[model samples]
Target: KEKVQAETFIKLVLLYNYRVERIKQFTNVTMGASTKEADIIVYNDDTCTKPHIVIECKNETISELEFLQAINQASAYAYALSGTIKYIWITTKSKNEYFLIDKDNNIKQSIPDIPQFGINKIQKYKYVYGGREQNQEAKKDKIKQQFFELETISEKDLINRFKQAHNSLWEGGKLDPSEAFDELDKLIFCKIWDEKIPRQKGEPYNFQIFKEPLPKNATKEQLLDIENKQTNDLFNRIITLYNQGKKEDPEVFKDNIRLSPQKVKTVVTYLESINLNITDLDSKGKAFETFMGSYFRGDFGQFFTPRNIVKFIVNSLPIDYKDKVLDTSCGSGGFLLYALNKIRLKADVFYKKDEIKHYKYWHDFASNNLFGIEISEKIARTAKMNMILHEAGHTNVISSDGLLQDIEIQKNSGNKEFKYNHFDYIITNPPFGSNVKQSEKPYLENYILGHKNINWLDPSKNECRDNQSTEILFIEQCYNFLKVGGILAIVLPDGILTNSSLQYVRNNIENWFRIIAIVSMPQTAFSPTGAGVKSSVMFLRKWNIQTTDKYKLIKQTLQEQIKKESCLKRKNRVSARSIEQPYPRDAFSN
Candidate 1:
């Protein structure tokens, strides 16, 4: 609502040439038995003796029905101040209606604009570029001009716009909710690309609608042709921009925009005038996250890790700009984004006076240090989009099972960054309660946790199990991704910590890593996102080669001692049985 009010205020000052002092905000008017506040009231004089125009504003997200109600409300205000008020304007940021109040006739007539100061006749259009004057009287008054540039908005406003645009696409049931989300993502990408394009001051953006003055005597067919041509031109321009972005980062999207030209225009209308590139990064990130969380929590909730948990885990780690980070199950890239933001905050402190340096410091880290792997292709793309919305760090995120071998991950994702023992830190909240069957995912056989019998003395002797829980495999997968002595902060179910049956799994963790800390989380921690299992975040450091070798030798010695003890017990038992059988045979002979 503030966005609408600010926009209306600007248009009144710059376009209509309204004197700032003559315009009053939140002016109260007497109703039947009480009073109500008008959003904006313009007076004919600086003393505010006579009201000239009364304006009512609503948020851009207001429904059409609600907007009409606002118009009626504005008309009531006009009647309350009947004799003096000449106009009633109802507006949202994207839609507007102007009226000329015929107080004597008790009628309200639609108009293109309320007349400007010292003008008796209203113009056909409030704004025109490079056009002849509409009338001789209008020529006497100087026309005030303003240009549209992409503007930054608050987080609440941004989220509202996102929700409003997304609803406009799917509310008619033309496209399913998921398809609408994909189309919206594509259009938002195009909008951001359009904003980054170089342009001179006062130059219009191609992403917005351009009104062309048509001839008065034009045929109906000509008008239809012009409208179709305009839509086609806009669609072509948007596609060109989208293709350009895809050319730069081929992995961001794998499909062209599937929305019709009209649908595409609908999305563009919601996004074109906002400058996402210049918006505060934290605001942008949170806005996208809040919007995305609501959608995914209903459809792909298992892939989402609550933001509070993500922030908690990330904050507890000693991550730095120089550290190479990975989220094995990077669902929507929440952990990676938090890590990136952590580094960005550091950049702010280190490069306090230099804006370019500040951007470069964090941007370099995001481009070079962050990596992720997600099994679901759709969720992986969502993760990539999330990263892009946060400004960068998406190039290394790939769509592949986190448990896949490094070579297989590389082959599947076409990104060579998924190397064993390479990342400096691994942070993830792998999906819990899902069993990965060895038959279904052949890669599971390669994980020690996937084995039914694990031979700690010699890993090669381990027999592969038919199935294993995904969270267990993720523990080992995160270990594989981290370098020796590197950190792993993973969310795991409480069963892994206390279940006697998973002792071997615990033993494997002991052999491979040095336990740092285990922070138990409440069962309800993830309830809001649809996860209800009891969980904890375990922080571990991968053992160095020397420590791992020492553990292997210790296990070997223990296995040898156990074998020797078993042989001794068998020999003693045989001797005792033979002695007892000899005495029985002598008695039988007697």
Candidate 2:
């Protein structure tokens, strides 16, 4: 992505006032545990947490699949960044070519309200302005005057028409075609939105991946209906394809079908990835980018933060001086960074530390206090770059799972290392699925599910044998590391929160963590993930002793909620209260 160069240009504008750390991009590996590498990762050396200017290069006409592709990459960056970039500016070749990447995944994005592409009208006017192509004087003075007038009359109601033109001249305007483009860029950039659109004004369309998501507060029958509809759609498509048999161009057949739910969606998503078509400035550049995946990574990062949501998460939580923050499954490190900023700001406001002193300590303390673990190395790398923006390289983010260390040893007479003490605070959006499994390890002791200090895990149970489900173990592990009084606010699959099958797990954890609140999230909150696994923000605090009471608390709450639930009331319920109390390791509940 041109973001590396784009950031460099931005850094240049900031100059010595702000320092740029790295140039290569970064990414996390998604297998086993997360790992990291970089393409262009830069850390800002200055005290500032965000870039003075955020530049998102724009694309011209784009296809639907490309929009989805853009969402995936941009959402990842947005997920990874809690505080870094601000408002988005997509740089494109023409006036009608700008679009902001909505990092927040808000379905209701405010699109450009006006038709700015109208200024393409001035392209021909400039050609005849000067006889010679390189006449700088005649080009600037005259064309600039035209740009000044044309900008207002064109597509957008620019906030600063003169400023846009002046900045166009700032770079001396591309020298390729002197008079023609001297100040043409001003109009092109200022009127930065591509008006040539697809999805005819009112043309009906389904996302192809999904038309309507299972609605909020859906009935059990409604959920079942939604599921059945999807299953049928996929099954019908598969039957059609199977009956037709395979062909040279399998995806193109008019009657081609996909049978399985996974297969259909897989086919659609991959096709979308491959067929993401977007017209950028030069055709070659656009082609090369799609060929290299710049379309997704670049266009996605262009969207700025979902301001309201970020504020809500950051504002809702109140932090104190001694709290140690950890963000497991940290995507772009947005929450961690925002939390750090909040603490720094609050401390400065009340702690009596002078502005300069507090500023220095925030820069130093934030780098050390915030730790992140990301599952995707690519995303992790993005996270590191993001942390660097806040000048926080010392946060000790691991490319591996935060819940488990691949290489760790106990030192006898062990004084509790900060690493061993429970985290003071943990806020994260862990992967949602029983489908995520641990990477290949020599062995996992059955005892961990039961005993500890075994140095191995037995994969005997169906869940273990498949090793397809990875998240439950980490959920268990997050409980393990937190200190008795530490706070944890996390996003999890609702199933984990209330499922009776998890009673055993809950029994062990109830004493250690107390449920505080749960913020029901909308399905589209992470439209790109598309799983919509009934997610919720569950907050808790680790406690000591009193495991039974905690277990009771958890059970009673589940039962209470279940009573109010109209759908699952009659369905077979997992008995939280069995004939005899359940033991840890014997059952899984949390």
Candidate 3:
């Protein structure tokens, strides 16, 4: 039964300190995705419509799961109203939690307490049951200072902590290599979700694996038992939150956690204190990338491209909020993360103080517009987790081969956008020099360059070429993904550009794309990935067919010139080679 009116909690909570005139339990406010009742809406002024803080009330004895559900409801109400709401609070007689919405609409939850009546002044309340509100403004400042200090986890320690966790899994024989990574990924995802969700007053923090401290004198068996119980409970809660997340947004998480009780314990111990979601973006990327690098090398080094080069290439391109971007061979999703960051930077500059109004745009672009495909199941899960850390949902990162786009799309017939010709930009550093061969008949038949037929224009030829490397086929795959005039920034081996043997690959690119610029990457750029091969980042735009019409007009003009000056133009006859070769270089820049 409902025990109290929403206004009762407000009077008990906000009116105790805040100006009573500024608070209201508005009825039937319709500002969000759907029409629903917002329990308690607080205003900054008498206008009442200027929502500064929104609260959703529940009875004091609600279950943790119900409290978490109320949190999602509160977040939706805050987002639905006018974009001025700075804080969203959920409270009961016994439970209280607060959240601050940043300029970019990133809701950082579980802030120490609510803000006071004035600007920059936070209200400090002892979350203890039956405790009185602390009166000293100086005491409130001290608690606020502590809240700010929580995000100060050192980058080096964070990376080391991940490394330690990964080492524990690798050392123990509890799971296979790939299985270990995937299980660890599920746990990490759960940890992030756990931090943001609201908990009952007595319930432990979601990520804190142990409910109580272990005794120092406990034996190994006792310790293992404790770990096993805590880990299973933690993952159980994680799965609940994950299922809830998937319901709210269908594509947020893909796989379920499949770790054994022992292995889950091994990983959770090393990660208990570290907060994956609240850490700085750079720190998160570096820590995760470092962990990925250690595991992904030797056989799969190409997936771990240097972040510096990714940043350089992404910076070179001109990407906007409107363009839908993809990485066909996204290893751990470095390019997509950098691209999302670029959009956020532009939003920060353009919207300034009102960025929260447009925060939904950037958020949508990250989750919906940005896409990636990774072949390795383990790496795909890692990439998804990486995107989640960057505030982008990983629903679009297909875990199939980059070249198997058609077959994958056919199988996933329900997901229509899974097909080709959808992305506006593609940036990737495909696996090169590994000499990995593609032999699958169906997959091989789909590639234009998978066959030795020098003329892809000759549709009559159906012979499949043997031993085609994936990197070579990826060039064609990227071409297929891009719309007309869409840009591509890809890392290519130096041999493909200069070796006469691979000139056909260059010719195929020449025909399909107008090369915009070529910047040679140092041999050492990929050395860490066990790839010392020389490579370069090439920027190119797909050749629009409409431009061919202009070229045809130019060809006609050239033919006329050949007829007028027989002596000078006779040497250069109006042949196919003569018409196509000289026109592109002179027309398009280097």
- What are the runs in model 1 whose C-alpha is more than 4 Å off? 1-11, 19-56, 59-61, 64-90, 94-144, 172-174, 217-229, 353-355, 454-462, 559-590
Instruction: Compose the digit string of candidate 1's lDDT tens values, residues 1-590.
Output: 87789889887887567899999888888778889988998999879979999999998878645876998988888888744888998977755667777676666655545666656655433322212233333446556323334568889878877887888788757678877877888888888777777765444566765544344455556666766765677788899999998998788888898988977766766776677888988898899999888888877888888999999999999898999999888989999999998998898788873588898899999999999888887788888888888988788998887888999889888888889989999998888889998789999888878887466655567688888998999888888888998999999999999999998889889899999999999979989888788999999999987898899789878988988999999999999998877665467684
Q: Give the better candidate number (1 or 2) by TM-score.
A: 1
Worst 10 residues of 3 by lDDT: 125-134
TM-score of each model, in listed order: 0.79, 0.40, 0.62
lDDT of each: 0.81, 0.42, 0.68
How do the candidates rank by lDDT, highest first?
1, 3, 2
The window of 10 residues in a row where model 1 has the poorest summed lDDT is: 127-136
Instruction: Give the per-residue lDDT of model 2 (tens digit) for 1-590.
Output: 35434544463334212234422234342333554332222233244343222333334233323434544443344334445432222322222111223343332221221111111112211112112332333345433312111111211212122223222333333322222122222122111111111333222112122323535555556655765675466445444434332242121122322123543343333121111112221232222222222212323331112224444676777776466777767765667767776877776675566567665666656755677766544455445544543445433654554444432412211212335455777776666553433345423332143322223233223233324234555555566656777777766666766899665545555555677877887866554433446667777877664764666677778866876784465443444344356666847766
TM-score of 2: 0.40
Could you tell me the C-alpha RMSD of candidate 2 in Å?
26.8
Q: How close to the true structure is residue 493 of candidate 3, measured as C-alpha lDDT?
A: 87
Q: Whole-model lDDT for model 1 versus the true structure?
A: 0.81
Candidate that scores best on TM-score: 1
